[model samples]
Target: MFRDSLEAGARAVAAHFDHVLSDAADLPVLHAMRYATTGGKGLRGWLVLEGARLHDVAPERALWPACAIEAIHAYSLVHDDLPCMDDDDLRRGLPTVHRKWDEATAVLAGDALQALGFEMVADPRCHPDPLVRADLTLSLARAAGARGMVLGQALDMAAERADAPLDLQQITALQAGKTGALIAWSAEAGARLAHADLAPLTAYAERLGLAFQIADDILDVEGDAETVGKAVGKDAGRGKATFVSLLGLEGAKARATSLVTEACDALSPYGHRADALREAARFVISRRN
Candidate 1:
């Protein structure tokens, strides 16, 4: 059931991407946008849909922010893979946007996708209330802007050139901004849509977000490039600090496990109704990619 919901959510968002991009002008940037958005787990989008489901928001209404988060996420990946950034040549087993197209095209594609994300949430179709739309747009800006994901990315790049690697506390704070910000927003979006309390989902996402990064750190150490779908062991190669670096491999796994448990506990308010989210928490730490 969990797998089914996740795959369905992915398809729904992918279809939304096509529907929205279809109205855009026929340009290379649009093509790059579509390419960058495809072929992923769609975990962030799924979180939006599921949180909406838990709050009784219709899937149709929920899809706006679901797809929006995915667009923003795709944009981050495209920009992160650029020559000036991580300089990766591959993503999801295919050429990175910059590698497949040119750097200029990749930049335009990522920028357009980010704009499209805000546009979708602000659209009347997302919510009839102007306040709801405004809220979603504002939160997304904070999550994706200088205060959030961008801050994290900047810290990561700085760490690479720093005289000393980031300590565990610094790494934790950085991941909260970088990888965890969007996920937190995605998880709590349903509550925002319903105008309900954000505390529950926010707590769940904090632990879940940290666990997700830990899992990625684990995969970097244990996974192969072919299996992980991008370069693996690059963190270690760069002598970067990660959960795995600060904690032993077993200790990192243990910490991730503990986080998943706390994440599941945060959903207790919803009882068995949140089983899929619980499963998602477990899946985060267990996935190979």
Candidate 2:
């Protein structure tokens, strides 16, 4: 059921992208942006939708931030797969943006997607209240900017150049910013839209985000490139510190399980309404890609 919800949400967001991109003239960058945004689990966007549902927010309104988060996520992957970043050739079972096009196209596509993400929440379609739109825009900027995702990326690059690998605490902090920040924003977006309290979702997301990263680390150790839709074991190849490196496979898995439990528990206030989110937490650790 959760998988179904996730897929449906992904489709809805992709459709939104198609409609928005169609307004722009056809170009290589636009094509590259479409390519980059397509074919993924869409977990973050799904979280936004599900959280909005839980808050009684209308899908018409909820979709703005949902698609915004996905655009930002797509942009991150496009850049991450570039030669200067992960330097991968594949993503979601297709040639990565940089590999399919040129690196310059990839860079431009990424930049455009990032801008599009902000534009979604800032636009009047997102919410009628100017203050609400401003809040969403500000929070998105914080989540995607220097204080959040970018900070995590910088830390990651720094770790790569350092002699020693990151410790557990250090890695956890870095991921909280890099991966967790956007996730936090996605989960909390619904609450912001509804002007509801954010504590419950915030607690769920903190654990869920960390578990997601841990699962990714485990996947790198066990997954094949064909299934993962990207390079596998790159962290180990580069001697980078990961959950699997620091905690061992079994230990990392156990940690993920524990985090999922905590994340699910954080949803108790919502009763059965939160079941999908609980399942999402389980899916995080179980998914191979």
Candidate 3:
């Protein structure tokens, strides 16, 4: 059911940025953005729909916002793969935008996609509440900007230097910003869009976000390139701070499991309405990539 919902939501906004480069007459960059955004499993969108499901809102009504989340996520990945960033060449089993095109085009495509995300969230089809739309914008901005993902990236890059070694707490803090913030925002934004009170949901997303990162770290350690679809051992090679670095492989996996348990417990208040979300928490730990 979740898979069907995710596919439908992804297709709904697949052409959302279709006119992105129409006036400029350069379709490839726009195509790159569309391609990157559409092909993912739509976990972020699923999270939004799942949150709405917890509030008994119709999944169809949540599709536009779900697509918006996916657009933002895709844009982040584009930039994250830049030479100055992760310098990755592949994503989702395809050449990255920068590698497929030129670095300049990739950068512009990422910028365009980010703008498209805000535009999609503001679209009337998503919802009627302007305040809620503004909140979505704010939530997305806070998650992507200096106080969140970018700042975390900065810290992560800086930590590579021998002068600064991240303690376990610091590693947690970094992942909370880099990985957890976006997940929390995705969940909270969905609940807010459904007009649900967000306190418990926010806390639930917080724990789940951290769990997601811990799982990612564990994957980086145990997963192979074929499974993860990116380079393995890159974290350790780059001296990046990871849960596995702070705690051995076994300990990191334990941390991920504990957080997944806490994430599931947090949703108990939502009862059966949160079944998809509960399953998603489990999926985070179980994912191969």
Give the top-scoring candidate (lDDT).
1
lDDT of 1 by residue, 55-158 (tens): 99999999999999999999999999999889999899999999988999999999999999999999999999999999999999999999999999988888
Relative to the true structure, candidate 3 reaches a TM of 0.92
The whole-model C-alpha lDDT of candidate 3 against the native structure comes to 0.78
Instruction: Please provide, for model 2 over 51-165, each residue's C-alpha lDDT reduced to its tens digit, 9 standing for 90 to 100.
Output: 9999999998889999999999999999988888888888998999988999999999999999999999998999999998999999999999989999999999999999999
Misplaced by over 4 Å in model 1 are none
Deviation of model 3 at 206, angstroms: 1.1
- Residue 93 local lDDT, model 1: 95
lDDT of 3 by residue, 140-250 (tens): 888888998888877787787658679998888888888877788778866788677888778778888888888888888888988688778888887777888888888
TM-score versus the correct structure, for each prediction: 0.99, 0.99, 0.92
Off by over 4 Å in 2: none
Task: Record all residue pairs in model 1 with backbone atoms less than 3 Å apart, i.e. clashing.
Answer: none
Query: Between prediction 1 and prediction 3, which has the larger lDDT?
Result: 1
